[model samples]
Target: MLWIPIDRSLDIPLIRQVYQQIRERILNGDLQSEEKLPSTRELAFELKVSRNVILEAYDQLIAEGFLVTRRGSGTFVAKGTFLEKRVVPNHALNWRENKTDAANIIDFRSGLPALDLFPRKTWAKLSHAIWNDTSHSMFGYDLPEGRPELRQALARYLLKTRGVACHPEQIVITSGATQALTLVSRLLLSPNDTVIMEDPITNDIQTIFKTTGATIFPIPVDEYGIKTALLPENKKPKLIFITPSHQFPLGGTLPIQRRIQLIQYSRKTNCYLVEDDYDSEFRYEGPPVSSLQGLEPECVLYVGSFSKILSPALRIGYLVLPLQLIEESRRLKWFSDLHTPSVEQLILARFIDEGYLERHITRMKKVYKKRRDYLMHCIKTTFSNEVQVFGYSTGLHLIVEVTNFHFSKEKLKQIEQCGVKVYQVEEHTIEKDKHQNQLILGYGHLNQEEIKEGIARLHVALYK
Candidate 1:
């Protein structure tokens, strides 16, 4: 039987869901070429749906060439519909799924928020209200720059929270920072154009630039963020991608002087600065760091996402672009996916407007701070002076450098075998053999007890 689970609670229609699932199975080879599909009557009986609904779904699929029917024969998979495997790049090998004992493992993976801390009840209320009352006109395509309400809500929110000066017209909602970077790469970069990026940067950013055929010049990042003094004096790249607020994998916030120098460098080179303020909501020490875009709105393209603060599953992010790049970015985004879903956008906008977002951030910050403190305590008690932590007091994760331990492949595998998972900063490094002794421990998603136990297991794995 071709089983397609239909959720009655979804806003999508039952017939559309059935059609989409069958089409997906055909495309993915789950339904092989020439495979017979069950009759509409049998499928209707099996799924407990109306026979007319099954007929409608099948009619659409057949009309779309995903299915075929003959007088004497039943429906079958289309002949040319078998998808061939395409070659993926070597860098994508990191995406291979790890088969682990899920019941006992402790994960310290980076880029995850504490999902347990999200305000699910409020989100559900907003979601239900939005779905129930939204205009039927919104069921169709929306503007590529996103819904006006969301952009406006984000404009006021950014001005108050991040000190970003932007009109709603300049904000383009993206799937997340990933798509925002993709849009920038597509719009600003040409083949062989030069780009300057942090050496130990987010792997996805590096891959995005590489995929766009940009010539990447790697700059070493220190404790104070990307070394502004080391920026090329003679040549200039089209863009400089940076994480100024609590740098990724290593926690260095660019100081005011460096930020000024970077803006100056961008101005001199006639280039743009891509400032990714990914996890700025959980600042634990010192005053909140202001965004570089606020310093010089004309020179910096600021990107932010809710994935770090609220929930990654929401797939909501925005780019505060300079006036010059606005049109092209929107055109590219339109060609990419038209726009993010309108219902979710309205829900998030409401979330911001109703004060739930702020309250959630304030509550989660304290929770994460406690987890951070407990993790630091455990690391101190376990490794003592043998370990040095970086990127502390901010962000969901911190870097732990164990002086005597080298995270070679074998060592990492051994640690994994012991049911503890911690990521190495060296994996994100562009220059080989740097930061090999450092590991990134993400505490946002784990409780204090898990943090202590995970570190203890890691300690045994490394020491034993």
Candidate 2:
């Protein structure tokens, strides 16, 4: 006999409850394919439910294809109803444990900020205030772009800090830089559309663009940044993606001359440019550069995120879109997620409005610069004239080019066996051979002592 338990107190109707449970059983493979279910009369008697209720439940299941009924026989479980279960291998679990829980391993992975220094108390206070104090309407479905308060706060903050000229209406809050890039790719590109990107770009960035069915044109980057002169003349691309402030892995800042050329190229070719100013806030040595969007707001779609400065878990980033693309992007955002969470948006807005974000950035800049200096000092002391470091003095990471050293998988495994975790820059490169001897060292998450010790361990791992 089928165990059919019906609760009269449940908000869900009795018919729906029965239908859902049976469907779950079928999908979970508890009910074998083509197995006959108990007759309605028997089920109704077993549960003490009316014949009408049992009939209704069985009818729903039959209608939805969870069960099939033959006129002469009984209802049976549908074939092909069971879902495939996900299985995790033991070795994969072990790898994850070692990567996450192993002690004494110092990681120099890029794109991570100093999570230890985030102002938790202030953030909690703001979050509490927003939750308890804000209106009930805030908890409900709001605008697709974002909460108005957060968008307004972002407009003011961007203008004051990065010189990005934009109104609150032009801002669209996103989950993070990843979503921002995704929105742009979906809206702008069609299948087979051509896009120009830095040669050794981040894997996620490359994947997102590729998923749009776009063909990528890889441009070689140097110590000065993307070689703008080498962009194919007369070959008009649909879009150009760049990390101008600090190039990923390579750490080169695009020169003003090249930036101007890019803007002019965009204007002449009528192609859009995506300026991902991911870590422009952490410039240690030079004056902070303004976003390219400020130069030609109509031609460039600027992307900014708090992941590097605040916490990546915040899932808060914004896109300052061109006037023409505003409505379409917002519509796409609506279709994708409706909106970012209202509570988080409210908390971030309060954080920015109350000046907590600025104060935090100011304090962290000094700390990060100190850490950067220590890492640079340690590398110079250990390697002497044998190594050259690129993408230095700014952002969270640097690229070290060691003479005659190739970070093959076996070599990386050997380094890992020594309890140090450093990444090869070649991992991000499209043409891996070009950056075979270089490694990307992100120092933002590590302290001064960890930086020194990690470098020493790496040296020992290589030469010992």
Total clashes in model 2, counting residue pairs 3 or more apart in sequence or in different chains: 1
Give all candidates' CA lDDT scores. 0.91, 0.89
Give all TM-scores, in the order shown: 0.81, 0.82
Q: lDDT by residue for model 1 over 177-291, one digit each (tens)?
A: 9999999999889999999999899888899988988898989999989999999988779999999987987999999999999999999999999999999889998656889
TM-score of 1: 0.81
Per-candidate clash tally: 0, 1
TM-score of 2: 0.82
Off by over 4 Å in 2: 1-101
Clashing residue pairs in candidate 2 are 251-391
Q: Return the lDDT, model 2, position 438.
A: 89
Q: Compared with the true structure, what per-residue lDDT tens digits does model 2 show for residues 367-410?
A: 88898889989999998998998788678999888999888989
Scored against the true structure, residue 56 in model 1 reaches a CA lDDT of 98
Span of ten consecutive residues with least summed lDDT in model 1: 94-103
Off by over 4 Å in 1: 1-99
